[model samples]
Target: MSTVGFVMLCHTALDRAAQVARHWAEQDCPVVIHLDRRVDKASSEKLRSDLKDCGNIRFSKRHRCEWGTWSLVAASQTASEVMLAEFPDVRHIYLASGSCLPLRPVDELREYLKARPRTDFIESVTTQDVDWTVGGLNAERFQLRFPFSWKRNRLLFDRYVELQRRVGFTRKIPENLVPHLGSQWWCLTRQTLSAILQDPARKIHDAYFKRVWIPDESYYQTIARLYSTRIESRSLTLSKFDFQGKPHVFYDDHLHLLRRSDCFVARKAWPQADRLYETFLGPNHRESQMAEPAPGKIDRVFAKALERRTRGRAGLYMHSRFPRLDLENGKTCARYSVFQGFNDLFEDFEPWLSRRLGTRVHGSLFDPVRARFAGDADIYAGCLPATAALRDDNPEMFLTSLIWNTRGERQVFQFSPRDNQRICWFLSTDSNAQISVITGAWAVPLYLSNRDFSDIRKEAALMQKREVEFVNRLRNIGTRADVRVWSLAEFIEEPMENLQSILDAMDGPSAPRLTEAPRMANLDGFGQFLQNLKNQGMKPFVMGDFPATNVEMHQPTGGPRPYLVKK
Candidate 1:
């Protein structure tokens, strides 16, 4: 297998950039660095001096990076071309940043890719008919001179980056051409790299991108899709992001979600996120190596990530391409309509979510302000406290909604051995004669439109009769328990001063039978009511009473209680 070339782009991360460089050095990959041009001479000298001991590290002259500008791509293009010029034998070139940490052990990634050398890791995403996510669509400002602009002049940079600051880049979509999306950082084959660097037709792809949209974020992904004949995987990393639209925010709570994303890298972190980053880099992350599942697993993981993004029809802010799913031959893909009013930062993210929400539930990427999928998407259900509820209260729904269902076996709804509940059925608008159903993982975007009302709520009569029946379903198996519905309004109707009462009701150790299951009815009121208490400083998993949603371990009203607890 040929050696890999790592092209790292850096800006303000002086103190830690060298450590990242050292890590790549240890991986034995060729290293190429491009420090941002605007970096001060003193800082640049210090960084170069600090990294002097790493014989393999090569530094490029710093180029400035404007927050929302595309000038930065000029530096990257220059560096990429330079790297290829010097080391033409390198099999692959990967784009990364000073802050990004490799999720896989370098050897693991190398071995995984060594076997399949033709696929390009870039994603070619399409949502051409969609509008800019910001609101109004403008292509002139959205596309740029250099692809990424380093704030050449702070005033001009401010003016350039301002619109995107208030409104995100996704707010605009170009006509005719679907926005080809992928990772800004991708592992490109030497063939693709050479195509990008040596092609006589580069100007066509380049000039078109200079006027299209999201210049830097879209450049690489689009060019590859337009020119390169082969594509490997679409996703380079999974990211966490926020309103300012710069990067994803990293915090202590995001730990578990990171584990499940199965991506090679995640970013938009604060300096404080360093400690958490180390955990993945440490020797113990559960996913560090997946038992070396058959060679195709890693590629499948990457493709699936891109597929999920495409399925949701969400806009990608990067510049790589994905393998076309529909085309199958690596040349075509599914297309989605990209409209800006379709996305809103505040609407998508619940204000309460940032502080203490369920860490288990995946965040929403759909346009929130438009409320297009308000009735559909899973917004707040997967909080930390809902784990048992997910496993016990509605295991059937959970199993149908989450477990991978490609196995094709009948998924049982109850203890019965023969129930084909894995399938979700729904009705379409073809004059009420339209019937639609699907069977697959009910995760995120899949469960919504993928299933119909009939599919999701299959037992119509039983489901419609009353909330109590729904509540009873939450009881432990064979336990005759009466269930009641609770709403956030009813819970929060109590004065804030009485917040302790709610928590007092919820806090306790109950009977063994209670441990077998939980009551999962309309807990909306209950959760809504808890918001006030939560705002009052009642911890999410408060061990004692202060502000809690009320749920008690109940025994039959006619019979003795399961057990009483000491306060």
Candidate 2:
């Protein structure tokens, strides 16, 4: 029988790595393990001990792998060479990560490869591929030399890269080499590996690829395409990417998809998601189990109770500039509509809000391009300047309307159209510095060449200036509009408590009876609340809390205090 060789690249989580090694070893396959040199000695020893029983296992010399560098490719090459030398008669070599889980049985895979005889399963695409347009990073990865360590001094490194771009300095691609991008994981025949290792241009390819950024993804795919016409442009490993180009981490929620995918392997799994590992590979495996089970009638009762307790009478509108705050269950208000600019809100979204408000809208003559406020609604719930504009455009709307500020800018002014009417709702932050970091993360990417600290601070300063100008205008128009500010962070931390505060300010109806538990608990407060409930013999129906809107502030703060508000 011609056996298959397995090469697994692992950095951390030795216990999980051991499990993966053992699984493949049990199938009578020869396995080569390459643990990253960065892993501590104790962990490495534990991994060795865990895999000591496997007779077919071999360990490769460790290499310290760095992200977006040639080290990863070096480690992979090291493991492949070891596997080829040890198992000379192996039919095919499968390359994967320690985090990867086998989606199909090993017997099926072995039989399938035996039938194909000479095919390579490698995902390859040219630089002209539409998918490479993500984050506009395809050009930069090939155009310049990223010599500096981005993890250590990201700001300095990005600035240097930008400076190079401005100076019009670019590196040349080697002759007779076309850059092809693809996933690093692949399965190749022994003949293909021998061809790659024995190629006359092997030295030249190595020398050139060492200087390339993220070469692991391109080096093998590019070479495989050049050498083999019998290539399948699909990887056996499955993965996902987010809008920001980060991998969407696999969790229990993705178990169903993994089971259904025809791919042999799946990657980018987290160490903390032990449930996924157990569900797929455990002794009593339950891969079909849903991550979140359907809620029972009791769950619905609690959900309705929480909804009644937290629902606001005033219409909620979120500005495009701010990140939409999600509930703990990853849900946002279903009724809200997003607008690009003030004009977009007035022209496109105003009619939608007017229908929801069911009131006569005034100021039809004002164009959004010329004027700040084109019209007003019965209630405005959004960021500072936009909410302020709603109050200014039609003061009559402010008489009985509510203005809920989501950005938490501090203000000392009171707005009361009548003795008992209060219209202004303030959402203050405990730390303006934190809010700046959050806003900077969202805004700086648009202006800067990359995500560097210097450019982020610069963009944040500009945002702070705009925030101050808007709040100043709001203060000037105060006392006429019943203004009340609530700390946004506080409300996010304690949803039930904060909902009551909002209703109290609006003079809305009393909250419904707290008869049933909530379907979702506040995430930050869940641990403490659950502990308290457990001691009192109670159970929580809710899964998660409202997602916190507060941006975690970092140390070494030296930016302009745009979040500063006058008391």
Candidate 3:
């Protein structure tokens, strides 16, 4: 049984904690919550009362907290210390804030943890002395008196931080000890947490950390560097930050942006951010509070699995029956396949696809294509959780979902294609490490820039127009060979854009900075041939035994599907 400890360190987040407590409790997972020192007992007690039914919940007493100060260290240490004592069985500790919400299901999160016993989720950020481990606190002030500490002095703290910024004295990682900085929010393994909590070398290292201006962040980085193996050095936290180096206040404008990142949680949203929180979570607007995913949610889950795999952002739960094309196809000739980049086309795609042999299929063997909105790094980032819902309960379906990330990797949401049975495709943004996808036919999104039309509402009009173009393209392409064009969107919508509601079938659910496209091609859609093959029960047939032509997959009688080779 895996456990998650949500470490809340602010009074402003008490009510949020109650909601989270109720959430995980219903999931039947254990939760350990703590209040910061300044949080009054009245609020804490009230929170405890509201969440009293939440089993396996424990609240801490020796709270040590001070905003923008090293006291945060004391608070985290105190909470973690107590957490270790109370829950010796906890395999992992996810230090989260009350404002953060789980984007993926709870079971998914736990499953991810169960696989990686050696890997730690805590990003060991590297910094010399003054570093970025949530760097608002200074180590020298750890035991300093409130009235005497310089960081405690509002005027001096600001001046000192600003001065440090002007001097441009960025942190350094000596060859012997490299430093990194990131969010304090972490998903840590027990071993890593234990080492930090009970370091025998703390006495020796403490003196050095004490000399640094802000050791709260550096202390962990230094210790982890000296200790843990290959810290990804990222807190996996993506809360919007302000110019002054503080968490930006999240508002309705930020709601959709947060979803696209495919991240498990986001942070620093204001208390009033409730409106956005309630309205836009990748799925339904209304919170279910249900123990199980509602009906037809399984398809959505499969769509996510497919999208993650395509993007290569698939985390621990990546399992696919798709045969390997790289080794046999001589993909080793290239370090990174050119196909690994982004491609986008707007018109003339429908007819092209109807001729392709890739999109055809009927019955159980015929898989419907569901599109996922991806691309445009300017839109948002995407990352998968450690674990996922069991495949048995969340079976994969052809028509899954399309996720959109506008605001250049900030907000994201899952969308259903109008034609789930027709076809689907993925595309990429021009160089600059962004991704974008066209679902069916969308009448050129206004601006097509990263700025406007950031909301999902903009999708309504394009959806209607594309559906018509889809069916026309399919019928037209099957009979014509002269047509040579491919729009990623039109291909997916052809046959019948409004064939079926894709989102109605969804169940649930990032990638890096990729560069642009320098080449362009006028290609043909292969759907027409694929459809005929599907009508044949997806049997193996060689198109033409020519190079770079139709791929022939061998199938023996009463045997399994065989290897695919280009004829």
Candidate with best lDDT: 2
- Judging by lDDT, tell me the better candidate of 1 and 2: 2
Q: Hey, what RMSD does candidate 3 come out at?
A: 22.8
> What TM-score against the true fold does each predicted structure earn?
0.45, 0.54, 0.43
Q: How are the candidates ranked when ordered by lDDT, highest leading?
A: 2, 1, 3
Which lDDT tens digits does candidate 3 get at residues 35-154? 765667788678889877766777766555555445666666667777678777777777777777665566656666666655666655333444433445543233232332454577
lDDT of 2 at 378: 32
Best by TM-score: 2
RMSD of each: 22.9, 23.2, 22.8
How accurate locally, in lDDT, is each candidate? 0.45, 0.55, 0.43
lDDT of 3 at 10: 53
Q: Predictions ranked by TM-score, top down?
A: 2, 1, 3
> Model 3: number of clashes?
65
Estimate the TM-score for candidate 3.
0.43
